[model samples]
Target: MADSPEDTIAAIATPPGFGGVGVVRISGPNTAALARAILGRLPAPRHATYAPFLGEQGETLDDGIALFFPGPRSYTGEDTLELQGHGGPVVLDLLLSRCLALGCRAARPGEFTERAFLNGRLDLAQAEAVADLIEAGSAQAARSARRALEGALSHEVNALLDALTGLRVSVEAALDFPDEDVDILREAQVQARLADLSGRIDRLIRGAAQGALLREGLRLVIAGRPNAGKSSLLNRLVRREAAIVTHIPGTTRDVLRETVSLDGLPLHLVDTAGLRESDDPVEQEGIRRAWAEIEAADAVLLVVDDALGEGEEEAAIRARLPGHLPVICVHNKIDLTGRVPGKQGGVLYLSAQDGQGVDSLREHLKAQAGFSGGEGLFLARRRHLDALTRTAGHVATARDALAVGAGPELVAEDLRLAQETLGEITGRFSSDDLLGRIFSTFCIGK
Candidate 1:
């Protein structure tokens, strides 16, 4: 692995397989030399020049466009080279091999982006957004990731850090003058400022939760008694024959999972075995697995036959589910029961066979996940949420200390902790282990 930003690294920037064009990216101190060695002489800065890629024997490897970007003004704040050539796998591999032979080592997964973060071209949050943008599953997710890459999340974190710093400064100053008549806690608006900071953190946390949902999505478990149209509902949601639909009660004997996006939000639909007591051992094991899925699910969709309405089985399953878990009661096969196709009193009446009232269920799912599509959402991860929550906790403790007239030393320490926690979100104060784990998930050449 390239240990330092000074080390030169190269990789195939584009994805694998044949395409019209492929790009090989090189960055670090050796970029200028490597470019000159391959292209005969360094190309003008930021300008693409048609050139021939030559092997060590001075023989033509392939003709392509070469562009050079000098240090401190480039993506990684270092000299960078991009060679655009035919997308043929062998040709691209040869080009990369030629560059490696010229003293450029292969780039590690996410190393290019890691270098960008190290050089201050992008902060930690923005660096993660680069990967998020590449892996975004929906148009909304892409837009959200783009906003985060533009430093939307870092901006909020930095603002919170600044506020904490200001509060700490005031407290430290007051500590220096122990005999002052007016306490800094009272004069500096410490309590009010802390309250406002706490509120701001709360609002940011809400937005981040939604963004996280956009990224990781919700695990939606479809569960109920046997022959409750569970397979039909799963098929309808995914718009395919994903699950084996049959009138037989025990047709589905195992869990089937499919991920579907609902208006930019992703729902990991898990079609589980019917939840009913059975004499057969196979059916019993399936029910056990269904319960396991329900336990881990973020939300549950309880599908009940509209003709059967609510019954002992439905009530039993609902009672068995975790109290905190969100459940959307779905009344499937409404076309047979002559029931209205809409949501009424927390229950969605829909027909899975003909796809009636499914839109209401989708809306209810969105509402359950608290995903209200809006602008300016920053792509966030679970780690970011944990940091924000910790920061808020520290702020709350600091506020409590101030409210009770606690000494400036204690209040100041709490504020400092709060500031540090916020810094972790943007990598202003992060551990080496955290950095390694975050970057390791990215694909090579990112």
Candidate 2:
């Protein structure tokens, strides 16, 4: 949709369902007029007043609390109104219809937050955090999203940008005045400043990577021969019978996915069919799909029967795993082997049937994700990580350029590019298409 602050927008702010209360939101220059037409009078700014919501013929459609927020101080940085009434779908629709009849257009998804970003009330990162907070799956994810909404990530990015700007100014100044007796770059310690900036960016990259992990979680695939306790491991990790546990080979002929929270980190576990050559078309197809899942997974859990031990078949499975993907070899059924449940030779030894050594596997997954709980973490998206990574690359290039006695012009350009790249996270250098793609994912009435 077009960015039109002049046009009034209204929507059912609450989710589409029956609840104790639902909110119909309105914002624009016409908010005052709409309030007068619907509420009979504009309620005091930021104050909730109980009133009857009027219809076209001045009929009382519903009675609820009306709240008015004048321009520049509201969520959208414009005149905003909210109607809190009974949450029946019909009632909410009636209230929304009244607003529409009085000159308010229906709000598109994320229009409210989009307006907030455009009106300078929140940066892009904070606007995205608003949605992240709503979609957070765990307490730690919620806390991280809250921190980001409160400008934790933005503060760090802005500080880095400011420092980079200052360094760029020094480098450019040296370029402008070549005949000066004083080497401005040397005097200002440009090299040291660049080095320091690079170090800070590196740290930020690491933190953002962790935050990204918290946001996106990990897609782990459990792959092995049939009846190797892969399904048992899946059910054990999720603490439920998510997959069928049968002694028959190839009992699991398809991929089954379940999500579990490991101390706040979301683990998307996929139990795939056993990987073994079979003449049956259905079994062959399952094996093909299993390999497909393995190719797309972030990590693989290669479960093997400890009683059977690692044979040539297990070695072949390990050999087929993607080299870049992290693979955790799980030696299950330790109970059958009369061995203690623990980790040995970096391979997890566990009995999935009786829940032995599962806790260790949980810790291993968390550690592999680099997630240390919510403590001081900020929620981040893949785009944020990508921007930071590109910024780091540019900064490193500039540092190398400076070290190699490169001209001030070349160093200044690289620093400028680095600053611009960093600005993408905060919308300073973002494109319209980027904003559209980012905000479109948010639910309506946000």
Candidate 3:
């Protein structure tokens, strides 16, 4: 179904500032009327017509290309118009003002895409991929976003939903026909199917987890005693002198952060002050902040100077780190120790000063992040992961119930819950508030 044409909306679709060309997009029932008024004639549907844009007083505002898409075929599944003109801000503003003056209201942020979703042109996940594609930081991320927009994730989710639906029907049928001698719930074939479904859900969860990692990169915090080459390691990872390198201990009295793409994976690296008891108030504050970063980090790179080896100080730092967080023990300054650069016993040995063994650290970080080079991947948000996790939990519970010969009602309820939870990913089951919150984060015109 297409959106109603009565309440038309308009926006400058192109980004702000000067460019080779700018575009003003309009959609609604009034699109044709607006086109005739501005372009002097309704453009041929889906054709690019060169024309002059006219103001209220019959004056030429700008000369450019006008494109029209009729209802049920446009992006919003409504009558749509796009005016391509010069990229100057003033020119675009004049064009937009002319649109508003012609009774088209300015579009809300992401209203265009929202309308498309509402009109059944795209599902919720694909709509989100529109924004992810625009903000993608790497080629891999962009490709993943494109795949998601093309319905890769939605297809898998719907397949799971279909399987769940079939299982639910069979369970309910068994409940309805209690006189049957052979109990479907206790059948070996049914149990096998349930196990297979659980396996499929687990596989989807792993893929979604990887996609989530690609969407939101890892936060890695570097921590150790002063002058352990923590700052040098940060500089080496980012390929820049992002942090000050000094011989003096406690030279870095604050946290320094740098974002770098490590093999198509976004790596947020934070360098913190040397962790130790300090008499100075400023250094004490720095140490406090450093611990705070470690607490919130996805992983920590615990740097240990090769000269110092794994001493009491390193042990103490290890004891303080969060037990659940992944900690990569980095043995730095291996050049001086004449040790080869590589990973040994889950610890990375390298020289940050000489750029030795950094590649090993990169691979280790990627492995820790569960990033698989973005192949067969799709962009996913934290909410998507949450939904997938919840769905998997419900499916597992259903399988367990089936194994225990639980009542059909219990199994059916679990299957139903799992289906609905999975549906949230593509918005087959969603609330208005959730939709509002998701679209609000998108930029205007998209």
Report, for every candidate in turn, its global Cα lDDT versus the true structure. 0.86, 0.85, 0.84
Q: C-alpha displacement of 369 in model 3, angstroms?
A: 1.6
**Looking at candidate 3, what is the lDDT of residue 162?**
96
Candidate 1, residue 145: Cα displacement in angstroms equals 1.1
Candidate 1 lDDT by residue in tens digits, 2-89? 3666679999999899999999999999998888889999999998899998888989989899999998899988899999999999
Model 3 CA deviation exceeding 4 Å by range: 1-6, 182-187, 240-255, 273-294, 308-323
Q: What is the Å distance of residue 277 in model 2 from its true position?
A: 12
Q: Quote the RMSD, in angstroms, for model 2.
A: 5.2
**Clashing residue pairs found in predicted model 3:** 5-29
TM-score of 2: 0.89
Pairs with steric clashes in candidate 1: none
Off by over 4 Å in 2: 1-3, 184-188, 240-255, 274-294, 310-323
lDDT of 2 by residue, 299-374 (tens): 9898999888778877777788888888888999988888777788889989999988888888888888777875
- Which candidate model has the greater lDDT, 1 or 3? 1
Worst 10 residues of 1 by lDDT: 241-250
TM-score for each predicted model, relative to the true structure: 0.88, 0.89, 0.86
Question: lDDT of candidate 3 vs native?
Answer: 0.84
